[model samples]
Target: MNEHLTDPASEGPAGGWGSVKSIARIYGETLSNPAVLETLKQQNKPGGFMCVSCAWPKPANYHPFGFCENGAKATLWESTSARCKPDFWNDHTVLELRDWKDHDLEMAGRLTHPMRYDADTDRYVEVSWEEAFSGIGAVLKRLEPKEVVFYSSGHAGLEASYLYALLARLYGNNNLPQSSNMCHETTSVGLTKVIGSPVGTVVWDDLEKTDCLFFFGQNPGSNSPRFLHPLQEAKQRGAKIVTFNPVIEQGLVSFVNPQSPRQMLTGEETVISDLYLQVQSGGDVAAILGLCKVVVEADDDAKTLGLKRILDVEFIEQHTTGFDRFVDCVRTASWSDIERESGLTEPDIRRAGQIYVEAERVIGVYGMGLTQHSKGALNIAMLANLLMLRGNIGREGAGVCPVRGHSNVQGQRTVGIAEKTKLVPMDKLKELFDFDPPTEDGTHMVDAVKGLMSGHVKGFVSLGGNLLRAVPDQRDMEVAWAKQELTVMVSTKLNRSHLFPAKAAYILPCLSRSEVDDQATGNQYISIEDSFSHIHGSIGKRSPASEHLKSELAIIAGIAKATLPVNPKVTWDDWTGDYSLVRDLIEKTYPEDFAKYNERLNEPGGFYRGNAAHDRIWKTPEKKAVFTTPDQLNSLSFPDRPGRYRLLTMRSNDQFNTTIYGYSDRFRGIEGTRDVVLMCAEDIAEAGLAPGQTVRLVSDFEDGRRRELGGLVVTQHALPKGTICSYYPECNVLNAIDHHDELSKTPASKSIPVRIEAEP
Candidate 1:
């Protein structure tokens, strides 16, 4: 397969008529007619369903049509008219479906019936809901609690996730692992240890009042386009924007708001970044350390001159610890090492540091670029250190913001869907449910995969995600997944994971966030938390595609009722009837955070959970924020060899995490295919390769395993020399399962060492 290349759009801005056209095309393809306008209007509104795309926060005064291009794609993708019925499943065999592409499988439409894999015929047959639930429970009853792994995706709502977590604990284990383990686990672990909070301290209003916005490894234009509105407004108010990324994402260069009629008519583009430092892949740690060094040296100069000290000495002395050690570590870092690792000169680093020092209030935003590396947690800690130098945390308009991918991923963690036993309030769970919750640590994503491969884990339960398509070492995950005794997937549509069935596999259709979910009591509303830690209600307005489809909350409750013995204190049926009862239970379990959960959810723009760090009240052991130094100065170490390059995987403009929307990547000037590797012109020639040539990438690892991806077309890009980029999941084959951060266990997908060779 070869990719069709084209010059990227250099005329219009990022979100102008191009976005409008893309939205129209998706609606046309999905046959989302008459309901399109209604769905678009309701998205991100006060009483409307949350967009299932990104976790960007909804402003108090939200736009009438607040949806972005990708948001529209997600909404229509879920609300499409096409249906996958019993007939479709009967005609297609599991072995045949496994050969289909990820995009084609999802385009087959929403699952409309409960299905069970028939090993005799190698095909799926429709099964009654009761029979499916009872059969799954029978298998669960026979196996040890530790043998089953319960997984969730960001697509699940807060109500469903809370019940899912409770069901796992009540079943006598804490083996709950979800999407965050692969993405922002580093941010949560690093920030909690330093500031005593896992979530970002800044809110939506803070973006509007900030003096400087520093973006590191985050591309909001594609991942979260709604965020561009804030950046546009911030730029207009004279705020400086600095970016540190390997690729010059179009979204970061300029933007043209489709919501603004004047800019749409005039074609005027607002420039986004004042300084764009193309940092090498996995170089965030060194770059941040260089910034810290500059800040500390500037403070010394200011003190010598008897001028105002550059550091926030009062805030540092009163509210923090270990600052002296952190400063000493930064002062000792070598300038040459910083330049070589960061791929930038001292002048550029000083310019960015000067911008940081001059600003009164700054907000630092980042994404997987920093967290998907071996030094992921350390990268987050270094950024926190830089912010602390100026007393950025716990302030009105300043803090660190980690942009999450899924709409409710952060919410899922907030509601106790974690693998760590100590992360949840075990005492509260036992008191409310009248059962002794498990105390042992459970498996995370990587550990779960290892368990399956080793045959230690016998069953798999997924609330809403394609595990096989999202994780590393895809070729091995599929084989390991097939060996499970039982597999259950509760989802709205069919994906690749559903095809790789175990001895006993079932696919249960569920109501999506866009469709109305009616229970025994009345219409139901689910709550979702955004990246800003705000919780709000989402009421789906569209009609259901099938009569047999059940709500996620209902399905989870049914599974719990069948698998666990009835407890007098826990009433699954009543909670499923009315979600408010679940909220009451949540409030009782987390009195400090979820107090008045249902009442406050009705407020405009919802309510903030209020991080202790934001109020300058650290909850650490010493009751103060602490700064720590990284153990290593280098982000990555590679042997000196020719034809070696650092390969990073990214998402196309037309895709979300593993969910490919189309074949075209308009931002990168590629069209008609996704089977291509982006490389710098110099590196291409040095390797005796040229643009449009098909090449194979072989990963270099110490394990001595042969990990290669073949038949990938080469395309020219503006990346730094010795660094290459490709789309994720497709290129995940090159990422070894064990190559990840030691502390957080996030796969090092952003910085894989690989060699390119001509495809034989």
Candidate 2:
């Protein structure tokens, strides 16, 4: 596992030769049969299966391949030719498998049967689906409704997520702790408070028409490679793209379109960013404040300088409130404070501000780098203010775009997957489903883990994803998982979470998005919503990997029926038989938005789930977009301690969230290892450390506990002084569960105060 293969990159661009090699490597390793081709074909065709890699909006016209390299990896990982059977489990025990790597565990292949943890043998033994359901139901019925927590992930389809929420509420608990709590909870909470909606205003089509696109802490080449196509087109159309980040990500600099054979063969790359600003860790708020201050200064001197007015005075006067307070806050922010906080000079901030002043239609794009902080909500508010200052909302090519992580994460929320009771409106549930939903607010991820540790959460059910590995404080999460009285996981493949068994644990295998679900009513298809609120269907056309595997929807129905044997208020059998019935119920719940859910899926490119901000329809208490002025002084203050670096957790180019596709980060010039740290050369020299030196990272927190990780090989890069980077989940140990955004409860993975030392 410690074998390091280093081939420092010099020439090839991302998505050109690197992607071809990666795709070939995936096919070679997976040994996927020809059936995978049909799986991919259905994945590309309209109204077919949608990619579960990311929530990036699909184009009106899709590529013949219809997916990126990472998307292909996710597909191949799901549709691999390997299988983990009873024999495989008999050969290895849970404690022995604990030594396996994350990718190795995923590579163990799909689970073909329902398995239950046997404490005597310390292995998972095959069990009947009925036995698994009955055992889990026994615990569910014994515990109080509030004691059970239902966790959901973005990988689950909207239909399954809706049924999961319904089942949890019907059983009497609203403790719906979802993956969104770890990814974009800030965007969901912050944007709603500012512009009266949880999603972004602009659609995918707007990228082609935008005059200027500002990237705030987003790396498209790795996270969303397909997004690069629109960016490439926008660049060719004379759109000015500015990027703000800490590290010099290769994806933001240049890209070679893999779809184009000419560019792939010849090294003709498309330049993405016109200007790159390297801000310090957790400095987005300061950088944005400085940019806003420069914009206001330009507006003040527009007439005197013989320049056109930059700020939309009419839009501000009529469509916004608190502009006066925002302006006052920006005016008082001194350049000295901005430069110290942002690690950028006054000229650098103004230069980017000048570009913003000139563009007519602008869109601001951001990812977890901006939202995974203590001041995440305020950071989002400031970005909204920047967009609103120029009348960016209610337009075709202007608004904010929060690049979401998992596919259908947004769709799940739309169909009803939330911890807050008010977000779903219980009265509507009572009207349509005849069930009185829980009125009390449920626990989020942080609180859920706390509840599990304190014995408050007795029973746990997961729709998808490895909750233990994905959450912060890995040690504590494992302990919490063991404390649960009953734990049931509905999954397609084997993962790390299954190894951490509870007193009563069951692993129920479910069909993946690439597998056809044959229910009582022929085939069933599920729909998902993209980042831009585009609703489309994903009908799996491939055969099931194993006959024992059941559809997630069917499993949910079975569990619901088993848990409430006497209840007849809700019809789980009816919804599971025909998925359209679920859609009909969804339409009744959201009459205006999902009026013709089935008919809309039949459209050429599916239907656009209209954005309220796009139409200037604010659903806020003030009935207008509100401006927020965040305190610059209260920003994440770097400790005065010497030799401490602000370590930011990042994903390798080949990895997506917790899923490691490979060991190489081809785009970042690191190959053959995820066990390395990226830091500034100067910082290494300052600490008296040499190149390729092995070191351990010790996190500093207010709580009197030292979290340390050793055996990391250091690599020097052009990172900002006192800044370092490491891959997530591996570095997740350094992140204290309590160290999170106060407003959103999202872990501060992007900005953690740590001190590096030589491994002893």
Query: Given candidate 1, what's the lDDT at residue 593?
Result: 81
Question: lDDT tens string, model 1, 266-347?
Answer: 9888888888888998788889999998999999999999999889999999998999888888998899989988888899
Off by over 4 Å in 1: 1-12, 637-641
TM-score of each: 0.98, 0.97
Clash total of candidate 2: 0
Q: Tell me the deviation in Å of residue 148 in model 1.
A: 0.3
Residue 595 alpha-carbon offset, candidate 2, angstroms: 1.2
Q: Which stretches of candidate 2 lie over 4 Å from their true place?
A: 1-11, 305-307, 633-640
Predictions in order: lDDT: 0.87, 0.84
